[model samples]
Target: MSSSLRVSPFSHAEEIDFIQLVKITLQRKKLVAAITVSAGLIAVACAFLITPTYEVSSVLRPAAINELDALNRSEVYKLPPGEALTKVGASLESYETRLGFFRANPGFFKEFEAPGRTLEQSFEEFNRNSISLILPDPRKADSLSAYIKLEMTYPKGVDGVSILNGLVNYAIDTEREQIASDMRVIIKNRLTEIAGKLDAARANYEVDKEAKIASLSELDNLRRAQLQDERKALRAQLKTLRTDRVAQLDEAIGIAKSLGIRKPSTPSLLGDSERSPSNSVMRTEINNQQIPLYFMGVEALEAERNALMKRKSDDFTEGRIAQIAKELQLLEANREIEVLKSREKEDLFLAGVQPLRAEEARLRNLSIDMAGVKLVTIDRPAQEPLTPFKPKRLLVVVIGIILGFIVGCALAFIWAFIRNRQSFYRTLPISSSGAGATSLDGEPPRIS
Candidate 1:
């Protein structure tokens, strides 16, 4: 039952007209051969007429970030080599650079362009056909160690080499300028920052100085008040001492008068006061001797008081002196802080700004002569290629022949099918009638 259900639809069909199809195909054999031969000839002519392309390449090794670190001795502002190369690659691959290339050397590139090609068209064509930047060892990509293969292609081997070299040089110069510009911009920004910091530092120093000055002024006020109080007390004591001295002198003179002492030969050198005794006079010599002795004691007391006054005049209040000394220390301390800030400013410039500036200046001053340092090393220079890299004549001809045969076969089959269609339709009625007569019931004939 499974076998009967699996019967093919063509089981009742007549045999295929293999001989007639072969004869019809043979009649078109010349056309098939002509198409195939023409295709082969065309392939050969194209292979010969097409301009051969050659690739001229150079390997470049960029400078390492570690080298910059060695020069700078710090990593505060170090730029990685990979990052730098990335910028260079971006510049090299940029559309603007390609346009610039064509614009700069119109005469050289005109040979590569069609007669009516605009600069934009020329640029696009050049980008597609002329230049390529290849990174060898993609898996081991390190900016410092990775090699850049700068390749160019042209019809002429010499032209390929020359153009490749020129492009590499141009890319190096442009990238160096770009890198230099980047460095200058960075340094300029840093300098601006430093300037702002310097201003802030100065402002802080000034504010602190003012506050300290104010503090010193308050201390000075306290010191002055203390000194004034001390001076006032000293003056009061001095006045009392003067009054006592005067009273003692007056008493001595009175005693001398009471005793009726003979006037000294000096005639009262202390300005004798000849006032009469307040009470009855004592005319005894013992009283006379006592008057002299009292005058001597008063004289000694006056001398001692004068000496004390002189000593007090020469001395200063210790508290006030101590406060002044402390003020000086405060001033000196502020001065030291300002000095330190100045030194720090200088250090920041040296450590942060100066190195980057120097690098910028060096890059800015760079000429084509120093391209080697700014750009990567040229490990392998472009050499004139000896042979063409594309359009292998034998391979192209083989492909053309294969396609031509396939097309020829398809055409032959189609023509053969068209010629056999009428014959096939005429036989179909007869076969259907025969099948109906041979069937027993109303069922269709069984497929063998």
Candidate 2:
């Protein structure tokens, strides 16, 4: 049983030889150098073809406390330096603010315009790529300083310095205007509130005045009615007294005529037995009883009755009637109600409104010119950069050379590998049956 070992090409294991590859790469140094030089030249050309971009930047810091003193002192609106700085930073980052600046200054942004892009599209691209708002990192210690950096990069022909400075100014102005507008709104609302309070107070005053007048008038009317009733009663009593006096005088006259008395006579003038038994119609036995009307002679009684009938008013006889008449007269005018109704300055009567009026006046006279107010302080204004930031020619050339050298070495190794494989195949011996020869060890040959 004699078996021959056959060595197939697939059965040979290949091993890497770095030293060989290095030798092959060195042998093809000229080709590597040529590729590197070509790549360097291409990089130079690319550097020249690319548009140079220049950057302009500005640093913003919090405004001084004195700069914002006026606004703070107004008491209507108060803004701190740190808060103002934050607002300015927010405005700088606002897309709407940038767009508004662009729209206002179309000539300054002319360079951003391209053939295929509209003005809006160009602005969008510029805003996205060229504009940068760098705020302090909150994680770092420097964040305590609270600074904002605004940067704008533009092509060579574009005025990046002017654009950056102008944008910063625009942002500051926009923030100032917004603050002023807010203040105005606050003042307006405050004034409106004060006015409403004043109106309410005035309305309330009017209502109170009317109520007081009605109360006083009603009181006067009630008092007058009472006095009128008293006066009527007194007058009726006086009239009844007059009528009773006339009746008594008439009876006394008749009795005096029946007794033949023609003048005033005392009871003692009558005879003791002729006292008419002390119970006659002209006299009374009871000591508490009033004197009889017949005691006066007929002539005197007739004269008294005539005088009573001739009297016009009993008011003079009664002092209370006179007082009641005076009181009624006074009630007819109601001086308190008259004074309340005739008042022209009703505001003076409203209590606790002095402070409100003073506040309203202060708000009305509030003179705040926000234009002069500084919202943010510029630490470093944008300056024209002499050198372009992009398209570093030397660095680009060096990188291109390195990449070309790497590619050239790879190509050299590949070519050397192909040549070695071909030479190995040619040197292998073939068998009589046109097959590969067998190894003497009866194992696959290792390829190195």
Candidate 3:
């Protein structure tokens, strides 16, 4: 019922002239064919004349963070950073290679770096400045198959040479854009990671320094105890010497009294109080009962002092008396001095070690606080290919030929339709003997 309604305005009698259309298309087939073939050939020919380009790439892993113990932390205390410090340097170098390969040639780099730096420094600075990551384009893929196909594809354009130049420039520019960005991201992330590690090391150094300070204080206390013991021994030896000398002095006095020699009442006889010794003729006035008067105390100390200036003062009985007297005075003075020294030792014991300990503490803490994170670098380097890696001519030619054949088939099908052979109707003619059906109204079917 729907088919009988018929939607189109045009009558079946006014259908297209298939044979006329066939004649027209047949006449234009050569033109279309010529143009298609020429385009395919031009594309194939362009591949040969393009300037060849090469690429080289380098890969690397960034360093990892090191776990630190106290002892290991100490070694770097106040010490300059080691090779691990140069990771940034190494990373920068990688960036330069990646960016430089894409950015510009080596000659421009040399010229730019000629001032204010040695050849090496200039190179390092250049690498630092030029290093960057090139990101990949979403549309441009580098799958193994894609790469292989790209390598095999033919180039196409006007004049062949023009297309080849365009392809080479495009490839270089595309590489600069895509690879550089990806490498930059990798490099940036690696540098940030290294920085974080360094921060951790610095924190460790702080803790280590505090521990060292505590240890140093404990050592100072130990040393103070030992020094006090030594001072006590020196005092004991001095006391023993003083007692023995006093006993000998008493015996010397008894001998002089028994001999009936009276000592001078005044210190002049012994030259105490800085007085000169009396003349020998005056010796009779110094009797046995008075023998101890001149020699007992301060006078004896003076005599001792004078006698020490004479030769052999300690070798003889008389000289021994003077020596003992001098010895006694010195011992007394030393005892007093020792009293003061004990106080000073206590003061200085910690005084001497404390500052040094503090400094050590500070340095250790600095190391730990600095946290010994060594830098790690990751990189993608610029590459020079050993062979031209692009524009596969053979593959391009094959594809173009396949496309032409498909087009040829389509054209053949279209031409066949346009020809519209009448044999189709002749072979299967409609049976005109059947009765024509009437509409529901029972009159001839009204043409719509």
Per-candidate local distance difference test? 0.59, 0.84, 0.42
Lowest lDDT 10-mer window, candidate 1?
A: 1-10
Model 2, 1-448: lDDT tens digits are: 3345544543463666787667777899998888888888888888888899888899999999999999999998889999999999999899999999999998888888989888789899999999999988888875668899998889988888888999999999998888889999999999999999999999988888888888888888889999999999999899899999899889889999998778766565565547445544454443555667787888888999999999988887789999998998887787787788788888899977999999999999999888899888899999988778998878888898898888888888778766765555556656555445435433443332
- In candidate 2 the C-alpha lDDT for residue 409 amounts to 86
Residue-wise C-alpha lDDT for candidate 3, range 1-448, written one tens digit per residue:
2122322222322455878545655666775576568657866876666654333333333333342233244433221223332323333335443344424444334443556666566655534442233323447666221110011112121122222223333333443343335444544565465455545554564455456555555565565555445544555554455555555555654554554334434434444323544344454344455544324544454354344434232223334344444544444333433443355323232323444445445543442322233232223333334445456667667777667655654676566543433323223322234333432332332232
Q: Estimate the TM-score for candidate 2.
A: 0.78
Clashing pairs in 1: none
* TM-scores for the candidates: 0.52, 0.78, 0.27
How do the candidates rank by lDDT, highest first?
2, 1, 3
* Model 3, position 348: C-alpha lDDT score: 38
Q: How many residue pairs clash in model 2?
A: 0
At residue 52, what lDDT does model 1 achieve? 73
Please list the residue runs of candidate 3 whose C-alpha ends up more than 4 Å from where it truly belongs after superposition: 1-36, 49-53, 57-320, 325-387, 421-448
Question: Model 2, 162: alpha-carbon shift in Å?
Answer: 1.3
lDDT of 1: 0.59
RMSD of 2: 7.3
